[model samples]
Target: MFERFTEEARRVVVGAGRESAELRHGHIGTEHLLLAILAETEDPAARVLIEAGLDRAAAREAVRRLLGEGDDARALAAIGVDLDAVREAVESVFGAGALDAPSKEEPRRRGWFRSEGRAGRSPFTARGKKVLELSLRESLRLKSGHIAVGHLLLGLLREGDGLGARVIADHGLDFAAVRRAVEVTTG
Candidate 1:
């Protein structure tokens, strides 16, 4: 499948992996794929999204907020528990790196000779894999021999239930409108 990806499409996949690593995520989700496309300024998908008011920074923030805080945070906030304030207070007493330490989920390295856990490597999540598969389907549907950024966008939309879609919708950009823009730009 990767063999059929255009250079720009390949770059987006690579960028997604980089994004997942940067975020310390174990897997590359649909949100990371969207970030990759947005990070590539030269990509047509990025241009369309930017023109529609969904730039990289805005999208990134949305994804991070959603993933970082999650449902637990929302429930806590509703009950008047301020997680940020708690973190701040804890850090104030325990020093700057106190509250910002690595999560317990992260594997700890053991022994001098033992190699560190592959924290920097992130595999694609199920939804991410689906998106790539859907990208190929989209390329075939469009009668294109190579997968492109537009196809990737179509894949994300087709996946339908990812943070990427949520972020786009939250920003007031309709999915159909984004699909139209991608088609227009690629065509």
Candidate 2:
């Protein structure tokens, strides 16, 4: 499948991995893919997104907040949810360090090896893989010889339930509008 990807399409896919790694995530999600697509300023998909008001920084921040990563505390702070205060309240109700109790679940392993035998690499989450598959489908549907950025964008939207698609929808970019833009750009 990768063999059919255009250079720019390949870069977008690779960039998704970098975005995931930068976010300290163990796997690439649909959100990471969206960020990567938005990062490719020269791509038609990216230009359309930009024209529709999706900035890379803001989208990345929004995805991070939505995923409840390190930014979770900051997002909570914005809503006046003092996590520290919550911890304190919990500790006051139950003894000290009550909120800090160790979990029984084993700690996840981290090293230069994984189940797929890729050294020190993360895998694509299920939804991410689905998006790629859909990209191929979109390419075939459009009678395109190679998978292009526009097809990838269509695939992301066609995936329907991916975080990337949801964020695009949240920004008021409906499927019809984006499809039209992509078609125009491709032409």
Please report the candidate that would top lDDT against the real structure: 1
List the lowest-lDDT window of 10 residues for candidate 2. 111-120
lDDT by residue for model 1 over 60-130, one digit each (tens)?
A: 88987888644556678899998668867888898764744364454565521122244345667778888
Candidate 1's TM-score reads 0.72
| Candidate-wise lDDT, in order | 0.80, 0.78
Candidate 1 residues lying further than 4 Å off, grouped into runs, are 69-119
- In model 2, which runs have C-alpha deviations exceeding 4 angstroms? 70-117
**Residue-wise C-alpha lDDT for candidate 2, range 1-187, written one tens digit per residue:** 8888999888888888777756656788789888988988988778998888897887887887678544656688799997768867888999775754254454467631232434334688788888899989988887887898888888888887988888888777777888788867753
- Clashing residue pairs in candidate 2 are none
Best by TM-score: 2
- How close is every model to the real structure, measured as TM-score? 0.72, 0.73
Q: Clashes in model 1: which pairs?
A: none
